[model samples]
Target: MSDATRPRLKVLAAMSGGVDSAVAAARAAEAGHDVTGVHLALSANPKSFRTGARGCCTVEDSHDARRAADVIGIPFYVWDLAERFRRDVVEDFVAEYAAGRTPNPCLRCNEKIKFAALLDKALALGFDAVCTGHYAQVVTRPDGSRELHRAADMAKDQSYVLGVLDDRQLAHAMFPLGDTETTKEEIRAEAAARGLFVAKKPDSHDICFIADGDTQGFLAKHLGTAEGDIVDEAGAKLGTHSGAYGFTIGQRKGLRLGNPAGDGTPRYVLDISPVENTVTVGPAASLDIHALTAINPRWCGTTPAAPGPYTAQLRAHGSETPVTARLDGGELHVAFDQPVRGVAPGQAVVLYDGTRVVGSATIATTQRSTPGPSGA
Candidate 1:
């Protein structure tokens, strides 16, 4: 947010009943904003989501958030966004897998649900900014343009998932926890000091909608089971599987192949063909990708005018790899300095300039051959 904005602006804090978000709402209220806490009810069947104390996006989580809001002296409300989440994130997840690709539901939630749906409503309700616990900084340049950057705590930085946020979103976004150099331990301590009940709550690591963390089973239930052939790069049938959507690129376990490779080396899933209902397995080296094409580019600040040097992160928790990328013909093309493994279609490719997030796109295709440093 720009410095020119008023100090006591109306701020909507998204409280997920997590320690980080509780602290974030408290911090925002302390900062003198007219902060109001809100918990997003993302599932129609709340019981179908994770229900234990450690679970998120559930009835228990909403209770925790309401109690935290009372302690923070903010009005609390629950917004039922179950239909939107089902359409944008859940359905998209199933369709991506059905199309022989892997999708990150967490990242998609941040994009379609958190920023798009939530932020839009907040703006319509006269809120000056929407605040969250995401560990990413919004830096305002001299020209007053906002840029999204990594947090001081590298280990907990979430800029990769927030890469889907565009420049407009950055303008009205407030991350109370991002600028701090404090670790997770410090944050928890702060929450406890502030009398937040979620201080010691275990962090949720599973997909909120998939309560059991059984992704294969979830996909099978949604996409249905179909007997398919498991094949190799040479079009030779290696085995058969219940469904092609059950597997993921670069998967190395539960292949259930009839026999091991000729060299007795474990093979990895190199490709999935939904049309052919087949999964291709090969040596690990076959999973290395040198370049890829991405679609639906969303820039955090400004779109790059030309190809340039930058670093790319393929997964939310993945390390940044040196890359050269550019946008052309409505697609983002990126070339890695060294081949990286396990990059899959339907996953986002977030580009960064140093600690600042440039933008992100949905990966569509991967190539084993390099496309030159400029991705020409």
Candidate 2:
């Protein structure tokens, strides 16, 4: 579309002190949007600088974001969302782990903080849309509805984490990087060409709140010590653990089981019972799950015309398995075409039809086929 025909928008670009966001903000300005950059102060007591690529939300990160805004010649401001982040993301993470369930905080941030909280405020304050550097595409359908699709760069696609967004939230979301069929290297180069300070900044990885990647230690500090017995499926005691919440399904490491499996096979964590304070360990075959039930389903667009085939992803960066899904009694029941391993409860199971995100839900439970005499 030419500039004469293009509609000018009052855009709020969420800058995360990364090259991607810097370039995104630049692109928004280049497109003639009345863009303003905002950096989210998620960490209350941020360190002086980021340690490696483990975390963002540091003092230096905010400075970098500000410098990027200056390079882009846009108005910049920092929004303090530390308390909200603690309540919504950090505390929720601990609570989920305490309940013997795995939770993805990035997904929660997108659901609660970014789209729900930030977007609501942005729209109310007269902004037409909330732009970000998330690697996901939003397509405006011919019927004037918006559809969320995978990024052109498959390696950097982030639609899985963004599956939490509903159609209404997606309507006012802009992702400049999603439209380009380029890589992260090109984004940084663009930032360099634009004279942005974060051109050489490393991409942030790991959880933002957890400065060190010690999830077990972080949980131990918050939930405290709840001593539990680790046992096999037949209730045979294998060892003991500091807490049942410290382990996840299909985990084989850190169990410290004194005895090896009777048949000399590797043992993995099969289940975690917080109420009983027990962690169940079994052979690898026990991890194969055939069906899973997801609760509190949220569709990005609409419910399927009929129950049929769709690709379901259990984890971010996990394999997509073809499954037949149906919504019954407010729950999404998915039967995988093939047995999938490491299906964890409390994780978001996103459903996709081709590139478009159909819906998502929290995995409440999984059903596995019985192990046979010869194993799974």
Candidate 3:
């Protein structure tokens, strides 16, 4: 197709009734592409006042998205994805906690619900691509491969949560906010200037499906109470915990220990044993790890011929540390360049090569090579 005659892309903007998504739809429409606004209904039991206009799946949000679509002169629709979201993201989150792992629900929602399920549905409906407000960029390399990169706004970079998307998804995706130099405040101001309904909306913080940020309470309510013993590294009973699902790696507070160590130091949760219904506490040093194993890996762009050295990020805003990552029997093994702390299993480990996202996996286990100090 010639440059001018190239078919105008039919894009579906996943609006969440937020300033970011609102501006994204505006920008897409201004670019002359055929645009549609879609608000995903991922919550079935909505009780919050901010449901539609504030959270990801409120009726107010649907109306706001529809308003944005009308303002941009595009067709708008709401897709009920609650069943899939609950099954793939929420249930998996509970299961991960029950297994003593810390799950990143946002990453799960992006991988399973948004990109995988929503993308399929959009494509089946004849949309050329699915666009969103994700603060990430897709670049076409000289070799003609699509590469995922960090957005210009470092503080708002969302590549970590998007690291699991493969090339097929990347091919049919648009991130309109990727190149925008606007901050959240600026976006909100722009929305106000445009008289948008979500101009004064507060940002969503807690998990959308969960009523509150009480993760432990939510897990207990869903998975049933499994009270367990809180022990030290040597398997000495320190105290009793309410449940194994309540604790995560590197957590320091809420142990409820009546006494301190002999050195007057604090203890941290180092491991959780779901099988034994126990949580292991030790000095902060025990949280240090030099290597980790990850299962169910997904490589964006293209898979490396052989895994070598790369920088791995353990958290969304966490520092990128040097590590040697290799694919072993469909799994990923990452050996840190140095001992790193707070290497929690169940969190995402995203790998990168400079600005390009290499791939990512969920941390399954860690192997520590050095013993930590005593009574630390």
Q: Pick the candidate with the highest lDDT.
A: 1
**Which residue pairs clash within candidate 1?**
none
Error of 1 at 326 (Å): 1.7
Model 3 residue 157 distance off true place after TM-score fit, in angstroms: 0.2
Count of clashing pairs, candidate 1: 0
What ranges in model 2 sit over 4 Å off? 1-6, 371-376
In candidate 3, list every pair of residues with a backbone clash: 51-58, 52-58, 52-60, 52-61, 53-61
What shift in Å separates residue 97 of candidate 1 from its native position after superposition?
0.6
Which tens-of-lDDT digit does each residue in 206-233 have in candidate 3? 6776655567887889888867888877
Give the C-alpha miss distance for residue 32 in model 1, angstroms: 1.1
What's the lDDT for residue 327 in model 2? 84
lDDT per residue for candidate 1 within 1-376, as digits (tens), equals 5322337889999999899999989988887899999999988888778845434788888999999999999999999999999999999999999998889888898889888999999999999898999998988987889899998789989999999999998888888888878999999999999999999998987788888888889888998899988887677888999999999888999999989999999999888888878788888878778999999999998999999999999998999999999888999999999999998889999999999999999999888653311111
Between candidates 2 and 3, name the one with more favorable TM-score: 2
Task: Give the whole-model CA lDDT for all candidates, comma-separated.
Answer: 0.88, 0.87, 0.82
Give stretches of model 3 more than 4 Å off: 1-7, 48-55, 371-376
Sort the predicted structures by lDDT, highest score first: 1, 2, 3
